[model samples]
Target: MLDLTKLAREMQGISQHLSQEAVASRQRLELAQQHLKKAYECQQEVMERQEKWRDRILFANATPLEPLNTRIDIPVPPKVHTVIATDGSQIAPNHHEIAYCYLLNIGRVVLHYGQNRYPLMDSLPEVFYRPEDLYMSRQWGIKTEEWMSYRRTASEATVLAELVREVGTGDGGLGTGRRKTGDLGSREENNNQSLIPHPQSPIPALAMVDGSLIYWFLEQLPVDARDRILPPILEAWSQMRAAQIPLMGYLSASRNVEGVNFLRLLACPHPAPDCVSYCPNQLEKVPCKVFEPLRDTALWTTQLTPGQRGPLWRSNNRILELYADQTIYFCHVHVGTEIARIEVPAWVAENTAMFDQALGLMLAQVQKGCGYPVAIAEAHNQAVVRGGDRTRFFCVVRETND
Candidate 1:
């Protein structure tokens, strides 16, 4: 009986050891699988990099040839004007918070009511465009903030519709329509009819948003939303034409998927000259005339030596520093005979590359004089709020005299 007991104890010990060994083997297999996954991921990254290089080469070789320019000078009409409006907003990540700032330009017409002054035509024609309506939240994170902020602040389609309705019916306190009477009418009736005048020629107004948010908003819109917005845009176009308005444009500026800033120029077909073009470089020369005087007096005063300023001026390094430091700098640039000194934040300098690309693209397009109305918008990360958390997308409209 003692020997049998000894044998049973030995078998039990051996079984326990084998169980532990099996668990260890399973762990080893799992570790091997993880290593293989890492290797596969690395290989994928390499393949992607090689494919991108090949694509770049193909694109570089396929540059499109420029079109021939036909020289023509047409007489411009008197009282022909263009209206431009710009607005910006911020979107935060995973929240419902948003902020907005907007500016409207009604060509030469300026109207004042109480303490507020508005352009003759408001960009957000509907009451929905009120600044107080702007808010911030973070439910959707960064992506949601961007989309919602843009949806509310960057779309001019609603505003344009309101303008058309106002002009067409003369209903928004403008008192436009007049009554007419036949000769058979009595003297009092004739007098009343004479007091009414013909409808004035509608002023061409171009509502401009700062980015491609307008397009994006339109694209993501549901079928019902599209049905609601499209009619108003078209109606506005028709009213302007009926009133003999030459042309109207909507400009959007945005960044490409690569984060490069660009302007989306669009317009209704009209007799006005319009075109789209781009410059390879626009911010090459610093607006030194605007900055030199201020730099000497305020930025690089006697406290800072010329040697220090020298490094700052080298290839926008100083500008970048100022922006990173968030300091205010004065720029001096020549506008006509007088030197214009402009105060700008250092952040503008840090973002010079993006601004340059956007400005260059717009200037090139405006220079073309193609006779079609155009709108331009810009998209990129801009430091809008005081704190770093307020960073958001901005859009602007570009207006050209030509």
Candidate 2:
């Protein structure tokens, strides 16, 4: 329990500490703004040399296809378009439960606009009790939160892939589209119009997930666990790419600093940043530490209008080497309320029509939902498994078995 009386007494001291830090916070912001201005000035050289910095400087720098200061207005979305989204939730195996089992629930949503197409929203739940499902290796410990999260993401991607096939190409899903009722409702197929290279009125749609598309966390997992998680997500991305369906992962009010780290690469004082040799020995303040306090949102919100997006910045993480051809990219967009980070793959960023449509539809969805993507908002409503629900789920397992 919290001590409210003690907390009240400590409030003054907390305020004093915050007051002391205010000046320092402003100083860091000013320095970051100045460095961002310099970065924009030398933006061409930065992107030109950004590749070499990946090995030379050991920070998460980004490679951009446009100047950091460049902002594009969100395209006016087509009145007739569709947004398909998928999200997942899970209950890890608990020792306190009657049965040691985990549950994964995938929420699927499809909202078609302008035309008279009925929206579809559904949740699919699966339970796993097998040893193979709970353990990645014979030597591994209990399934951790990080482990289950990746599994949930894979499940979401797999569902999104199915939705894309049914919606984008009119081809039947890869047989993984199982709902509570085991049906993926019939989709209206338009074989005459292909999505690649911007089909004329051919499925103006975006497939979305709740978080980042990059599986960079694979770097932290053991080789065995990595193999289990990465391939499924990659396979899902591949399915979407082959269909040319523009996909995005909407991160609201993202505090990501990838752009700032790239700015650090440009601001490196040393002629060539030999990270291993220089970083370990540096006792003084790192030259680029000035920009560390700011996120991409802080820099772009001031420069962009509502429904405008910043330049596409390719992730420079070496873990992306495992990503093969599906290079991950991100950009900042102000969706009328706050600056958000939207992540996509290389193919989507390269195609102007697909890129604009995705962003435009994203902005439209956010506006329709009032500051959040509607499909994601609804999908979350479907995917979330509350504590009460978990209790009942385990209760059912206990009752049915006993």
User: Which candidate number maximizes TM-score?
Assistant: 2
| Candidate 2, pairs of clashing residues | none
Model 2 lDDT per residue over 1-402, tens place: 999999998998989999978877667677777877887788777766666555666666777778777878888988878788998888877888777878888887877776555566777777867666566543554245566677777778877877787776543221233333121122222223222232345667789888887766777778777777777778878888888888999998777788877777667777765576677544456866666567778777777899788888888777788888888888999898999899998889889889988999999999999999999999999999999988889998899789
Q: Judged by lDDT against the true structure, how good is candidate 1?
A: 0.28
Write model 1 residue lDDT over 1-402, tens digit each, in one string.
469988999999999999997776556444433432343345344333323433221111110011101111112222333333333333332223232333221111111112122324212111122322323213223243343444433233333333334434433212212212111111111111111232465433333333221133444545444444344434433443453322222222211111000000101122211221122233443211112112122221222231111111111112222223333322222221222222222333335442233222222224322311133321111212333333322221111111
Q: What are the lDDT scores of the predictions, listed in order?
A: 0.28, 0.76
Q: How well does candidate 2 score on lDDT at residue 144? A: 58
Ten-residue stretch with the least lDDT total in model 1: 259-268
Residue 175 in model 2: shift from native, Å? Answer: 11
What's the lDDT for residue 347 in model 2?
Answer: 85
